[model samples]
Target: MGSLIDRVGIVTGSGRGIGKAIAEAMLHEGAKVVISDMNEELVKQTADELKQKGGQVLGLVCNVTVTESIEKMVETVVNSWGRIDILVNNAGITRDALFMRMTEEQWQAVIDTNLSSAFKVTKPVVKVMSKQREGRIINIASTSGVHGNFGQANYAAAKAGLVGFTKTIALEYASRNITCNAVAPGFIDTAMTQALSQDVVTKILDKVPLGRMGTPDDIAKAVLFFAGPGAYVTGQVLEVNGGLYT
Candidate 1:
């Protein structure tokens, strides 16, 4: 049996990228996973693809920004699995702009989608987890949140807020045996970063002592450590960058 055999996990915004990689890692460890995304087609496609690999999986449409949607998601998972053992708040979007060029809409959208969504989803999930007195909550943060990035004022603020939220939630739930932590990735080779021009990417890589961009799997490995049976760590941010930001 896998390490997480019989465990039930839900990963939001898991249709693709780092989120999807996290879900896949958990599945390999013997956990049943719910793959959630706002895009219906993406959810279905990812769910089906993962299931084909012999993992127990479910796909759900979840808009983490909406409280009602989050509540329903928690309810559905609880009803199906009888308990939730893990929650990953991985759904987020980027609205890149300098402070002067950034619109109120851009700021609000990023905050709501990145920071607020974690709160909405975690609130209901925490109720069940608190009762069981056993759970893991991992938030996907970014290095941009740690060190301010160019043309990413909104994204940085939202992700930085997530780090604070992670700490508070960890402190509040520690007594309940639910640990919360954040994984801050830097210059991962995701679709978003791949779109950058070579010159831009080159400049970004020059700062990294390792001289390479991290992969989704690199971030996934860090998350799996937190989810594992041996991790006593919580309320901390693990930087998955290749020595880019200290």
Candidate 2:
């Protein structure tokens, strides 16, 4: 994909799962990538592996909930590379519990990780993007944001907020060449989902007409579309479910 040739990118929570896949895909497309995660060791290992494959890669620890961490990560990217072209806000957490029994900390933790983190990272990128007047941003949302799930009020609210945030950013940057959009994934086979009870997976599968869960690659490819081909597409939420909602 020469379209993304020589582009620079950042993928948050890229130590593993869908984030890792997106980082890999971006590298395959000839883009230099910055992989950020809370796990310094994992990010370092993953970045090293990608580098072994001759990809331009940088790894760093970044807690998206902290503005300083976000700023440091971006600074590291600029110092290592020279610019930022694409950004994927994929870092998120889950503190699932029934609302009736959920504590304030539980609800706040999910929102902070899923939604506030987006604001933290995107804040710096926006300035850089606005200065350059060209950029691509993809926020990794979830199906829960669209169709609420049981015991995921916080996650759902955060994901839905991402959709709204994306739309607003798109409008704000429309005059420039920047595009902001969201990719809402459903039932992806990641570490987190794999840990779910088999019965839970089965119950979820029953709702999906596609008869199978999505893969990290599925989400990665969608991210690639937004970062490259979907330049004209912005302020939209592309649900990457296996026909779960439809």
Candidate 3:
């Protein structure tokens, strides 16, 4: 049997990209997973695909930034599965701009979606996990947050905030057997990166010792380690950056 046998996991923004990869990894390990995203069609499509792979899946539309939507999603998950063993805060967006050129709206939008959404979603999930005395929370962060990229002021701040949130949750919930950690991915070859010009991609990748962009599965593997029942680590930030120091 897989390590996560019957664990119930909620992966936000799981319709595609890294989020979808993480959800797929958990499902392959025998977890019942919730594929949640703001895009209802994408959520349904992802859930259907996973189900065809023999996974026990649920698709829910959730706007993590909204308290009402978050509460509803949490309620639905609990009603269906009776418990939540894992929560992956994988939903995020980027609004790239230099700090001087960044607007208040851009900063707030990124903060609300990437950082504050965790506060909204985790409150109720943590309550449920507390009662159960066991749970895992993995927040998807970014290397840009750590090293500070030139054109990603808002995105960087939001992800950096997420890292802080992860550590605080870890400290506060350790006694409850709930582990919270962050996974900071570096130069991942996702849809976002694919949009960059080859020159830009090459320039970014040249700094990596491995000389290649990381894959979604690379991030998923790290997440799986944290999500596994046997993990004894918490309050840590694991950088899955193909030997890239920055």
Top candidate when judged by lDDT against the true structure: 3
lDDT score, candidate 1: 0.93
Going through the candidates in the order shown, the clash numbers are 0, 0, 0
Clashing pairs in 2: none
Candidate 1 wrongly placed segments (more than 4 Å): none
Against the reference, the lDDT scores of all candidates come to 0.93, 0.91, 0.94
RMSD of each: 1.1, 1.1, 0.8
Give the number of the best model, judged by TM-score: 3
Between the candidate structures 2 and 3, which one is better when assessed by lDDT? 3
Task: Give the per-residue lDDT of model 1 (tens digit) for 115-166.
Answer: 9999899999999999999999999999999998998999999999999999
Tens-place lDDT digits, model 2, residues 117-190: 99889999888888888899999999999999998988899999999999999999979899999999999999
lDDT of 3: 0.94
Estimate TM-scores for all models. Answer: 0.97, 0.97, 0.98
Where does candidate 3 stray beyond 4 Å? Answer: none
